[model samples]
Target: MRRNAQALFGLVILLAGIAAVVATRDWKIQTAMYPRVVGIPLVILAAIEVVLSLRGAPEGERQAVDTALSETLPPDVTARRTRVAFTWIVGFFLAIVLIGFPAAVPLFMLAYLRGQGRESWALSLVLAGVAWLAFELIFDRVLHLPFAEGLLLQILRR
Candidate 1:
Protein backbone atom coordinates (compact mmCIF):
# COMPACT_ATOMS: atom_id res chain seq x y z
CA MET A 1 0.00 0.00 0.00
CA ARG A 2 2.80 2.41 0.88
CA ARG A 3 4.66 1.67 -2.30
CA ASN A 4 1.47 2.15 -4.27
CA ALA A 5 0.90 5.54 -2.65
CA GLN A 6 4.46 6.61 -3.50
CA ALA A 7 3.95 5.49 -7.10
CA LEU A 8 0.68 7.40 -7.32
CA PHE A 9 2.34 10.51 -5.92
CA GLY A 10 5.12 10.20 -8.47
CA LEU A 11 2.50 9.88 -11.24
CA VAL A 12 0.86 13.11 -10.02
CA ILE A 13 4.27 14.84 -10.00
CA LEU A 14 4.85 13.66 -13.56
CA LEU A 15 1.49 15.04 -14.64
CA ALA A 16 2.22 18.39 -12.98
CA GLY A 17 5.57 18.58 -14.81
CA ILE A 18 3.86 17.81 -18.10
CA ALA A 19 1.29 20.51 -17.38
CA ALA A 20 4.06 23.01 -16.58
CA VAL A 21 5.80 22.23 -19.87
CA VAL A 22 2.53 22.47 -21.82
CA ALA A 23 1.65 25.80 -20.18
CA THR A 24 5.02 27.20 -21.20
CA ARG A 25 4.55 26.22 -24.84
CA ASP A 26 2.85 29.50 -25.80
CA TRP A 27 5.48 31.60 -24.00
CA LYS A 28 8.53 33.01 -25.80
CA ILE A 29 11.71 30.94 -25.43
CA GLN A 30 13.47 33.59 -23.39
CA THR A 31 10.44 34.15 -21.17
CA ALA A 32 9.94 30.40 -20.73
CA MET A 33 13.58 29.66 -19.95
CA TYR A 34 13.20 29.10 -16.22
CA PRO A 35 9.96 27.12 -16.30
CA ARG A 36 11.31 24.91 -19.09
CA VAL A 37 14.53 24.27 -17.19
CA VAL A 38 12.61 23.41 -14.00
CA GLY A 39 9.73 21.57 -15.64
CA ILE A 40 11.84 19.28 -17.81
CA PRO A 41 13.85 18.16 -14.79
CA LEU A 42 10.75 17.65 -12.65
CA VAL A 43 9.26 15.42 -15.34
CA ILE A 44 12.41 13.38 -15.61
CA LEU A 45 12.79 12.96 -11.83
CA ALA A 46 9.13 12.16 -11.31
CA ALA A 47 9.21 9.56 -14.07
CA ILE A 48 12.30 8.02 -12.46
CA GLU A 49 10.53 8.01 -9.08
CA VAL A 50 7.50 6.26 -10.62
CA VAL A 51 9.70 3.59 -12.18
CA LEU A 52 11.65 3.04 -8.95
CA SER A 53 8.50 2.89 -6.85
CA LEU A 54 7.11 0.18 -9.11
CA ARG A 55 10.17 -1.92 -8.25
CA GLY A 56 9.02 -3.34 -4.91
CA ALA A 57 10.95 -2.35 -1.83
CA PRO A 58 12.46 -5.21 0.14
CA GLU A 59 10.06 -6.14 2.95
CA GLY A 60 12.27 -4.91 5.79
CA GLU A 61 13.29 -1.75 3.93
CA ARG A 62 9.68 -0.62 3.59
CA GLN A 63 9.12 -1.12 7.31
CA ALA A 64 12.30 0.82 8.14
CA VAL A 65 11.30 3.69 5.87
CA ASP A 66 7.83 3.78 7.42
CA THR A 67 9.35 3.80 10.89
CA ALA A 68 11.64 6.67 10.00
CA LEU A 69 8.83 8.67 8.44
CA SER A 70 6.43 8.03 11.30
CA GLU A 71 8.92 8.96 14.02
CA THR A 72 8.03 12.32 15.59
CA LEU A 73 8.72 14.37 18.68
CA PRO A 74 7.10 13.18 21.86
CA PRO A 75 3.48 14.30 22.14
CA ASP A 76 3.90 16.99 24.78
CA VAL A 77 7.14 18.27 23.29
CA THR A 78 5.67 18.27 19.81
CA ALA A 79 2.65 20.25 21.06
CA ARG A 80 4.93 22.80 22.71
CA ARG A 81 7.16 23.12 19.63
CA THR A 82 4.12 23.49 17.36
CA ARG A 83 2.84 26.34 19.53
CA VAL A 84 6.27 27.99 19.52
CA ALA A 85 6.57 27.67 15.74
CA PHE A 86 3.11 29.14 15.23
CA THR A 87 3.96 31.98 17.59
CA TRP A 88 7.14 32.71 15.64
CA ILE A 89 5.27 32.77 12.36
CA VAL A 90 2.62 35.13 13.75
CA GLY A 91 5.28 37.30 15.34
CA PHE A 92 7.18 37.51 12.06
CA PHE A 93 4.07 38.59 10.19
CA LEU A 94 3.22 41.14 12.85
CA ALA A 95 6.77 42.51 12.75
CA ILE A 96 6.55 42.86 8.98
CA VAL A 97 3.26 44.70 9.32
CA LEU A 98 4.40 46.98 12.12
CA ILE A 99 8.09 47.53 11.26
CA GLY A 100 8.20 47.20 7.46
CA PHE A 101 10.33 44.85 5.36
CA PRO A 102 13.77 46.37 5.82
CA ALA A 103 13.71 45.96 9.59
CA ALA A 104 11.46 42.95 9.96
CA VAL A 105 13.34 40.59 7.65
CA PRO A 106 16.61 40.77 9.57
CA LEU A 107 14.92 40.88 12.94
CA PHE A 108 12.88 37.77 12.24
CA MET A 109 15.84 35.93 10.75
CA LEU A 110 18.00 36.73 13.76
CA ALA A 111 15.34 35.75 16.26
CA TYR A 112 14.39 32.53 14.57
CA LEU A 113 17.94 31.44 13.91
CA ARG A 114 19.09 32.31 17.40
CA GLY A 115 16.07 31.22 19.42
CA GLN A 116 14.84 28.19 17.53
CA GLY A 117 18.03 26.94 15.92
CA ARG A 118 20.18 27.72 18.99
CA GLU A 119 22.87 28.81 16.58
CA SER A 120 25.94 30.70 17.74
CA TRP A 121 25.46 34.45 18.25
CA ALA A 122 28.13 35.37 15.71
CA LEU A 123 26.72 33.04 13.06
CA SER A 124 23.19 34.26 13.67
CA LEU A 125 24.26 37.89 13.36
CA VAL A 126 26.20 37.17 10.20
CA LEU A 127 23.28 35.28 8.64
CA ALA A 128 20.85 38.01 9.61
CA GLY A 129 23.07 40.65 8.05
CA VAL A 130 23.50 38.61 4.90
CA ALA A 131 19.74 38.06 4.63
CA TRP A 132 19.10 41.79 5.09
CA LEU A 133 21.63 42.68 2.45
CA ALA A 134 20.16 40.18 0.01
CA PHE A 135 16.64 41.51 0.60
CA GLU A 136 17.83 45.11 0.23
CA LEU A 137 19.76 44.38 -2.95
CA ILE A 138 17.29 42.08 -4.69
CA PHE A 139 13.78 43.30 -3.80
CA ASP A 140 14.57 46.90 -2.98
CA ARG A 141 17.51 47.92 -5.20
CA VAL A 142 17.24 45.58 -8.16
CA LEU A 143 13.52 44.87 -8.50
CA HIS A 144 12.43 48.35 -7.35
CA LEU A 145 9.31 46.95 -5.69
CA PRO A 146 7.78 49.67 -3.55
CA PHE A 147 7.27 48.51 0.00
CA ALA A 148 4.85 50.73 1.83
CA GLU A 149 5.85 52.21 5.16
CA GLY A 150 4.76 50.18 8.15
CA LEU A 151 1.44 50.94 9.80
CA LEU A 152 3.26 52.08 12.94
CA LEU A 153 5.26 54.57 10.89
CA GLN A 154 2.15 55.73 9.10
CA ILE A 155 0.32 56.21 12.40
CA LEU A 156 3.26 58.04 14.02
CA ARG A 157 3.38 60.59 11.18
CA ARG A 158 -0.04 61.89 12.14
Candidate 2:
Protein backbone atom coordinates (compact mmCIF):
# COMPACT_ATOMS: atom_id res chain seq x y z
CA MET A 1 0.00 0.00 0.00
CA ARG A 2 2.83 2.37 0.85
CA ARG A 3 4.61 1.92 -2.46
CA ASN A 4 1.33 2.07 -4.34
CA ALA A 5 0.42 5.30 -2.56
CA GLN A 6 3.76 6.80 -3.48
CA ALA A 7 3.23 5.81 -7.09
CA LEU A 8 -0.24 7.30 -7.13
CA PHE A 9 0.98 10.64 -5.79
CA GLY A 10 3.92 10.57 -8.19
CA LEU A 11 1.60 10.09 -11.13
CA VAL A 12 -0.57 12.98 -10.05
CA ILE A 13 2.44 15.27 -9.75
CA LEU A 14 3.91 14.06 -13.03
CA LEU A 15 0.72 14.61 -14.99
CA ALA A 16 0.19 18.06 -13.53
CA GLY A 17 3.76 19.10 -14.20
CA ILE A 18 3.67 17.78 -17.75
CA ALA A 19 0.48 19.73 -18.38
CA ALA A 20 2.07 22.90 -17.06
CA VAL A 21 5.14 22.42 -19.20
CA VAL A 22 3.07 21.70 -22.29
CA ALA A 23 0.92 24.74 -21.70
CA THR A 24 4.05 26.89 -21.80
CA ARG A 25 5.28 25.41 -25.07
CA ASP A 26 3.90 28.21 -27.26
CA TRP A 27 5.09 31.02 -25.01
CA LYS A 28 8.29 33.00 -25.52
CA ILE A 29 11.45 31.42 -24.08
CA GLN A 30 11.71 34.07 -21.38
CA THR A 31 8.08 33.61 -20.43
CA ALA A 32 8.43 29.82 -20.41
CA MET A 33 11.46 29.75 -18.14
CA TYR A 34 9.67 29.53 -14.77
CA PRO A 35 7.25 26.74 -15.59
CA ARG A 36 9.90 24.72 -17.43
CA VAL A 37 12.37 25.13 -14.60
CA VAL A 38 9.89 23.97 -11.99
CA GLY A 39 7.70 21.62 -13.95
CA ILE A 40 10.54 19.71 -15.59
CA PRO A 41 12.07 18.89 -12.23
CA LEU A 42 8.70 17.97 -10.79
CA VAL A 43 8.07 15.58 -13.65
CA ILE A 44 11.49 14.01 -13.24
CA LEU A 45 11.11 13.58 -9.48
CA ALA A 46 7.64 12.09 -9.86
CA ALA A 47 8.95 9.63 -12.43
CA ILE A 48 11.71 8.66 -10.05
CA GLU A 49 9.20 8.08 -7.28
CA VAL A 50 7.13 5.88 -9.54
CA VAL A 51 10.17 3.93 -10.65
CA LEU A 52 11.41 3.37 -7.12
CA SER A 53 8.03 2.18 -5.96
CA LEU A 54 7.76 -0.20 -8.89
CA ARG A 55 11.24 -1.66 -8.32
CA GLY A 56 10.48 -2.62 -4.74
CA ALA A 57 13.07 -2.77 -1.93
CA PRO A 58 16.59 -3.99 -2.56
CA GLU A 59 17.15 -7.70 -1.87
CA GLY A 60 18.93 -8.76 1.37
CA GLU A 61 18.96 -5.15 2.55
CA ARG A 62 16.44 -4.46 5.23
CA GLN A 63 14.92 -1.01 5.02
CA ALA A 64 15.82 1.17 7.97
CA VAL A 65 12.51 2.97 7.72
CA ASP A 66 10.59 -0.28 8.02
CA THR A 67 12.80 -1.47 10.81
CA ALA A 68 12.30 1.73 12.77
CA LEU A 69 8.58 1.59 12.22
CA SER A 70 8.44 -2.00 13.38
CA GLU A 71 10.36 -1.12 16.47
CA THR A 72 7.89 1.65 17.26
CA LEU A 73 4.72 -0.38 16.78
CA PRO A 74 3.55 -3.96 16.60
CA PRO A 75 2.78 -5.46 13.21
CA ASP A 76 -0.99 -5.19 13.44
CA VAL A 77 -0.94 -1.63 14.75
CA THR A 78 1.63 -0.66 12.16
CA ALA A 79 -0.47 -2.03 9.36
CA ARG A 80 -3.58 -0.28 10.61
CA ARG A 81 -1.75 3.00 11.09
CA THR A 82 -0.16 2.72 7.66
CA ARG A 83 -3.57 2.38 6.04
CA VAL A 84 -4.87 5.30 8.02
CA ALA A 85 -1.86 7.35 6.97
CA PHE A 86 -2.58 6.64 3.32
CA THR A 87 -6.21 7.61 3.79
CA TRP A 88 -5.10 10.91 5.28
CA ILE A 89 -2.83 11.49 2.30
CA VAL A 90 -5.63 10.86 -0.17
CA GLY A 91 -7.91 13.08 1.85
CA PHE A 92 -5.37 15.88 1.86
CA PHE A 93 -4.93 15.60 -1.91
CA LEU A 94 -8.67 15.85 -2.38
CA ALA A 95 -8.77 18.87 -0.12
CA ILE A 96 -6.08 20.58 -2.15
CA VAL A 97 -7.88 19.78 -5.39
CA LEU A 98 -11.18 21.05 -4.08
CA ILE A 99 -10.15 24.01 -1.93
CA GLY A 100 -6.70 25.16 -3.13
CA PHE A 101 -3.50 25.13 -1.15
CA PRO A 102 -4.02 28.46 0.55
CA ALA A 103 -7.00 27.01 2.42
CA ALA A 104 -6.20 23.31 2.34
CA VAL A 105 -2.75 23.37 3.89
CA PRO A 106 -3.76 24.77 7.24
CA LEU A 107 -7.06 22.89 7.25
CA PHE A 108 -5.35 19.60 6.55
CA MET A 109 -2.62 20.26 9.07
CA LEU A 110 -5.04 21.16 11.82
CA ALA A 111 -7.33 18.22 11.16
CA TYR A 112 -4.54 15.71 10.79
CA LEU A 113 -2.76 16.83 13.89
CA ARG A 114 -5.89 16.87 15.97
CA GLY A 115 -7.50 13.74 14.63
CA GLN A 116 -4.63 11.45 13.69
CA GLY A 117 -1.93 12.71 15.92
CA ARG A 118 -4.46 12.80 18.76
CA GLU A 119 -3.02 16.10 19.79
CA SER A 120 -4.69 18.77 21.86
CA TRP A 121 -6.71 21.36 19.97
CA ALA A 122 -4.43 24.18 21.06
CA LEU A 123 -1.30 22.36 19.96
CA SER A 124 -2.87 21.31 16.68
CA LEU A 125 -3.95 24.86 15.91
CA VAL A 126 -0.56 26.25 16.86
CA LEU A 127 1.26 23.80 14.63
CA ALA A 128 -1.10 24.49 11.78
CA GLY A 129 -0.59 28.22 12.24
CA VAL A 130 3.16 27.79 12.18
CA ALA A 131 3.01 25.66 9.02
CA TRP A 132 0.74 28.17 7.28
CA LEU A 133 3.10 31.02 8.15
CA ALA A 134 6.09 29.13 6.86
CA PHE A 135 4.37 28.20 3.62
CA GLU A 136 3.20 31.74 2.98
CA LEU A 137 6.49 33.34 3.92
CA ILE A 138 8.80 30.96 2.09
CA PHE A 139 6.81 29.90 -0.95
CA ASP A 140 4.26 32.62 -1.62
CA ARG A 141 6.07 35.70 -0.38
CA VAL A 142 9.67 34.86 -1.14
CA LEU A 143 9.81 32.28 -3.94
CA HIS A 144 6.60 33.41 -5.66
CA LEU A 145 5.78 30.03 -7.11
CA PRO A 146 2.46 30.15 -8.87
CA PHE A 147 0.34 27.41 -7.35
CA ALA A 148 -2.60 26.08 -9.29
CA GLU A 149 -5.90 27.22 -7.95
CA GLY A 150 -8.62 24.74 -6.99
CA LEU A 151 -10.85 23.21 -9.66
CA LEU A 152 -13.82 24.24 -7.52
CA LEU A 153 -12.64 27.83 -7.66
CA GLN A 154 -12.57 27.77 -11.45
CA ILE A 155 -16.10 26.39 -11.58
CA LEU A 156 -17.33 28.86 -9.01
CA ARG A 157 -15.69 31.77 -10.78
CA ARG A 158 -17.34 31.01 -14.06
TM-score of each: 0.54, 0.55
After superposing candidate 1 on the true structure, give the runs of residues whose Cα lies further than 4 Å from its correct spot: 1-71
Candidate 2: tens digits of C-alpha lDDT, residues 1-158: 76677678878888888899999989999999988999898889888877877776443564555435455777789888889989999999999999899889999999999988999999999999999999999999999989889989999999
**Each prediction's whole-model lDDT (CA):** 0.89, 0.87
- Model 1 TM-score is 0.54
- Model 2 poorest 10 in a row by lDDT: 58-67
Q: Would you give me the overall lDDT of model 1?
A: 0.89
Clash count (model 1, backbone only) = 0
